[model samples]
Each structure stands twice: as structure tokens, then as C-alpha cells.
Target chain A: MACHELIEGHLQALARSLPASVVEELRDGLIESYEDQLERLGDAEAAAHAAIADFGDADTVTAAFVRASPGRGIAVRLLLAGPVVGLSWAAALIAGHWWTWPISPPLRLAVGLVLGLAVLMLIVAVRERHHYRTVRLAALAGATGVAVLDTTLLATVVMLPAGPSVLLVPALAASVARVLLVVRAVPEMISDP
Target chain B: MRAEALKGHLDGLLLAALEDGPRHGYAVKEALRDATDGKLDLPTGTVYPALHRLEQAGLISGSWVVVAGRRRRTYELTEDGRRSLKGARDNWQEFAAVVSTALRGAPWPATS
Candidate 1:
């Protein structure tokens, strides 16, 4: 039997926040329940409304799902890794240029500010409050920091007639890779409804 | 009753609903309603998360079962769940007695 519009919409909303396997089982249960209600009430439309009302709204249900889900493990790992990775890249950049051109205090200050904000957001993410918000902000800040630091390093490598050290080349490559990951993730994370 | 009133008691109610045998999410909801004489109404969506939480806590177990040509997830109580339910029932009884006595201003011991 086809699902009622309201029932389908509610299930879809839940699927947005819950794992697909959980949602698949939930969908079946909902359909079966709705069918029973339809038989009892002898009216499909009324049964759908009753089912939805009895079930509660999508927001309440999804909130509970998120709170119970183990899905935040990846987010936790990313946030926990953020500062360590950022600092490693910073150390490499400093080693490469701190003695020669000194990379300008203003640029250094900007990187520090972004990294600080990223760390703060990461703290919030770890605490599990406003989870997706904190994770998104931290990822965005981390990505911006990567962009700023990488651009400065690349420019230094190019304009410095001395060129960068072979040792620093690997660190710079690693920063590029991190930048790609953060950039790829930001869109997906921020676009989450 | 309201959802807020039922919130703390929901875990026990869910365990009790599954006490007889394994049941799907919707069936559990229906059992809760029927047991409460339709007084314990809540949004149906909320039960799924509660079930997941119980499963995570190791009080209940869930799996997919085919029913009426469709797949549904059914939940059953573990030994732990049964023990917890007994504890919950005892606690509710004591709590209700305290509230009822206080409300009626009745003495603990009857005097003629």
C-alpha cells in the first residue's frame, strides 16, 4: 500500500538525521501502523493525521535520534585532529621562513586568529552542544586557515630566490592535502539541514 | 498524560511493552497507549529514538523481521531489561504512594 503524504514526509525528515538502516526499519513500522489505523478509522486521510499527531513532530523525533546516534564519531575525530594538524603545518612554515623574510607579522597574526577560533569551535564540538553548528564553524575556520597559510607558503616558495627547503616540501604537500579535505567537507557539512 | 510527564518513565514503559514478546516500533507504541487507556499519548516518531537508546544501553535488542510481506524492526527485552523493569515498577509504586499520601493529607497509619 502507498504511504500517506504526511507519513511519508515525516519519515523523510527523520531519514535526514538518522542512519538509513534505522530509517528503513522505522519506515516499515510506520506503514504498518498507519495501515492499522486506516482500517480502524475507515478513512485514510484521518488515519494519516492521527498517525502523525500520535508520533509527534519531525524536529522532536530527529533531535532524539541525533542525541542517541553514534554518528558523531567522525566529527569528534576531525575536531580532535584539527589543532594538532594545524600546529604541525605552522611549525613547518615557521621553520621554512621565520629566519629569512619572517613572513610578516600581520599574516602570522591572521593565521593565529583563525586557528584560535577553530580551536574554540572544536572545544564546543567536543562538548556535544549545538553539535553540527560547532563542527561546521570549526571546519570552516580550519579550512580558511589552511587557505591563508598555504597561499603564503606557496608565495614564499615562488618569490624567494632561495626557494624552500626539500624537507619543507613534504610539509607543504601535506598542508595542500589537508586543504583539499577541509574544502571538500565544508560544503557537505554546512549544507546539512 | 503529557509527554513531559511520561519522559522519565518512557524507558520502563517501553521495556514493559516488550515484556510479553518482541514487537515492532508501532506495536510498542500501540501497547503503551492501550496499557495507559489512551492517556499516555506521544508523538510516534519519538519512540524510535528511545528504542535506539535502550538498545545502546543494552537493556533491549532489536532486529529486522519480515511481517505481512514487509520488513519491520522488532525489539525484545534482554535479561537486563527485565531486571530494570522490575526495579522501575517498584520505584514507581513507592513514588506514587508518597505523592498520593501527600496529596490526600492522609496519615501513614490508620487510627479509629
Candidate 2:
């Protein structure tokens, strides 16, 4: 069952754009279909041809699978929500007097890294439509990154030397909201297929 | 029939195909083709992605198994999927009836 010639070629074409699991499932199905065709036609080549025809061209088949993925939708949702959450935190920080805090260059660097990852995730999600795996990876990374950064922000607000002031409420609220959303979405972003 | 004609209904049609029992992707394609009398409009390859999408939606579930000494991934409708399929059927029936009325140059039946 693993060794298929004609159908393997088609799968190879699909593998260029699809995840391995998706390609693997297609391989199984196509081989089964080819065997079914062989049973009736009694000619290997003809059966292969018939099977391939029914599945259509590599381009169309790959496109269909790509379109079916949820990665892009999740990425776009994260992208849309990011700014709102960002603005909320900014408002809280500016109003709460961020200048008095003993923030280090290393902490600032870490924050910048997370923000960079977020931007990269958005770019990949918006620009790359051909390969779904890339988008899925970006979303997973984005969610995890946001969860880490947001959790840290919430912790700092609670344990700050300066009392957790009412002005910090919006930032804390936004971080909590994002953490909840990330908790809900991260499992979904896991590669089940 | 044209693929265009089958657009937007592929998910429901796929759900219907899996209604009877769990089926491998190839079997689903066969069932769809047979049910349509060999006139299934869309490409057979599409069944995989549609099945995957349904799985993501929690409508159907897929698992790997051996069949006749060959590996295959099979799909079965979940409880949510059964409800979805029923909803699909209801919608299709209503749409068909309404469109049929329009096509026949007759007015729709009065709503109760």
C-alpha cells in the first residue's frame, strides 16, 4: 500500500504545498481508489489514470485542501484583537507612571522580541495563503507568545511596588481577556491532523 | 452538472455521505459518486479537505486504521455532526421548495 507510482507523483506535487499529515491522508485515499479502479479495469495504468482523473489535477486538489484550513481565520482574528489589547495596556502604563519603575534593558529586549514575533505572525498569516502549516505555526507561536507576555504584565501589575492602582485596571483586564482567549484557542491550534 | 452548482453545499453533502457509517476518504468519494449516479460535480480529491474541515468544526472525527491490509483514514459523524446534517437537510428542503416555486413561476406557499 505504501508503494504507489502514479499516485505517489500526485502526492509529491501536493506535498510541496500541504502538511505531511494532509498529504498522508490523501495518499491513503488515492491508493485505495487506484486499487478499486484496478479491480475493475484490470490494467494498472488505466486504473491509475482513472483514479488521478477523478481526483483532478494536483493544483486544484491542493488548493481545495488549503482553502479548508482554519489557520488563516484564527490568525486574522488574533491580528485584529492585538491592537485593542495593546492600546489598553498602553493607556494603563502611561496613566500609571511607567517611568518610575525599575525596568531593565533585558526586560525591554524581551518585550521587543515578543512584539516582533507577533508582527511576524501577522505577516505570515496575511501574506502566505498557499501553505497552511506556516500559518498554523505562526498562530500557535503568536498565541503562546501573547499568553506569556500578557501573564507577565498582569503579574507585574498585581505585585508592583506601587500599589495596583485603579488606573492599571484596563491593562490588567485586557491581559486577562487575552489569556482567556489564548487558553481557548491554543488547543485548537494544535496539529491534530 | 458543474462544480459551480455544487459550491456552498459541499460540506452538507459530505456530512450526508458520512451519515450512514464511518467511511474512508475513498469510500466517501465512491458513495458521493454513486449517489449522484456518477455525476458528482466536484473533484473526488475534495472529500479529504471537507472531511478535515468538519473534524475541525467538531462535526466529524477521523482516525487511522488498517483496511484489507492497507492503511486508511476513516471519518464518522459526531453527535454535533448529526445535528448539523439535520439542519442542512431542513435548510435544503426549504430552499429547494422555495426555489422550485420560483422556477415554476408560482408563488410561495403562505407562511403559517
Candidate 3:
């Protein structure tokens, strides 16, 4: 491949793993850097070789890009998932006997904590947008909230002999689905950096 | 020189490369090579990540400009970058002095 293409390919592949904005910046930077290399080395093929050799491989640069970028935290996805999963359980509860649904103190507390954290996550994701560490932490908090809620629901279902079947079952199922999504996504968020 | 040898010091060197004025990605890499007298030649692609890291850390800043019909991302050191560079240089001096003394078979407290 030509110098530019080689670098472009490397970056394009990384774009698959990183945020588009980051790959775009790296792409522009590399293309310009390639032209500069041509001027310095005075040979297209040799310059291409030098550029590739110096930049390391796709994997190495991608790793660096992942570390430098704010990460592809599934915050956006998780945020979207939250409402849908919550509604699914709500639907189940309403269908089963919404009037009889009991809101225990712990459930109320869990809801308060999740709402607080979700708001904080939204704030960081918006205000301190470029602060990757803070953003990721906020995302983790969201995931943790989901986990705590899911575990509490599961424990309630397992422990309480007289729990309402209609509401608790659907809530537990929805919480389980959310927990699964969080479980699957948490590693990707934390592992990138 | 191997990039491995320049690890923690590379950011300082990169900031120093832009001490004179802002330069595009390649120019900074060129300046790095020139400043090191060609001993610290690194993979050209690796520089962008480092540049991004520096920019993200607010140590430097970058913007795009068209040059010769192509978009180029040029970088310049921020005030924080300059301050960090000064600190890095002082640290380097201390480390270099110790290493130089050791390499020359001088005692730890040898007088100049």
C-alpha cells in the first residue's frame, strides 16, 4: 500500500474499536504526517516504509488511541436501555395487578440512588464531556446502580415467601435483563483504557 | 533511539519541539528527530497518539488548517505544556547528572 493508504487502513480498523471523532483526528494527522515524511525522506516508497515503521502496527496505535480517547463506553446504549427495560417490567407489573404492587423502603431507596446517579452521569457526559475518566466513572456508576437494583429484586423474589407474583415477577425479569446487559457491557467500558 | 528509552520524557521532548512555533504532526516528529540529532527516531504513527494524549491532558492544543490542498492538524504547546516542559527539563538534568556520574565511574557525591 501507499504511505497514506497504509496509515489510513490502520486508522480505519481502529475506528471500528474507537470513537469516530478520535479516528478522524488521527486520520487527518497521519495523512499530513505522511506528506511531511515524503518531504523529509525524499522518496515516496522509503517515506511510506518509514511512516509505517515509525508508527508501529495497527494494534499498537489502536491501543494508544483507546487509551487516549474517552472510550466507547456503552453509556449511550445503557442510557437508552434503561427506560426500555424499566418499561418492560412496568408493563408486566401493570398487567399482573398494578394496584397491589407494594413499594418497599429498599425499593424506594434503590430508585432514589439510581436516579441520582443517572442524573450525575448525564451531567458529566454533557458538561465535562471530554473528561474521559469522569465520564467513565459515571457510566460505571450507572451500571452499578442497575446491578444493585437487579440483585435486590432477585434477593427479594428468592427470600420473600409472600411477595406479589404479578408485580415482582415482571420487575425481577426486567431487572435480570438489565443486569445481563450491564454485565455484558461493563467490561467493554472499563477495559478500553 | 528506541522509543522505549524515551518513555516518560517523550512528552516533554514533543512540547519542546513546538517551543519555537506551532507545527503539524510531521513537523513535530521532524523537530523531535532533529533535536535528538536523529538518535530518537520513532515510528511516525505513534506520534499522533502521544499528541492526542498531550492535547487531552490540556498540555497542548491542536486545530485543523488546510495546507497544500489537504487538511492538517497542527499542534502548539499550551501554557501548561510550557510549564510541564520546564519541570521535565529540570528532572532530566538531575537524572542525567546522576547517570553521567555513574557511567563515568564517579562516586554518588562526586564534585564537578
* Per-chain TM-score (chain B), model 2: 0.89
RMSD of each: 10.0, 3.5, 12.2
Over A76-159, each residue of candidate 3 has an lDDT whose tens digit, in order, gives 656666777677666755665544546577766776787677656744543443344555677677667767766765664466
Off by over 4 Å in 1: A71-193, B107-112
Clashing pairs in 3: A54-B43, A54-B44, A55-B43, A55-B44, A55-B45, B1-B39
Highest TM-score model number: 2
The reply for model 2, stretches above 4 Å from the true place, is: A1-4, A161-171, A187-192, B106-112
TM-score of chain B of each: 0.90, 0.89, 0.90
lDDT of 3 at A178: 71
Taking all chains together, the TM-score of candidate 1 against the true structure is 0.61
**Residue A146's C-alpha lDDT in candidate 3?**
63
Which regions in candidate 3 have their CA more than 4 angstroms from the true location? A1-8, A33-50, A71-193, B107-112
Note the Cα lDDT for every prediction shown.
Answer: 0.71, 0.80, 0.69
Best by DockQ: 2
Model 2 interface DockQ:
0.67
The local lDDT score (0 to 100) that residue A118 gets in candidate 1 is: 51
For B1-112, candidate 2 gives per-residue lDDT tens digits of 8877887788899999999999988888889889989888456687787888888899999888876675678999999999999999999999999788789977667998
iRMSD for every model? 1.3, 1.4, 2.4
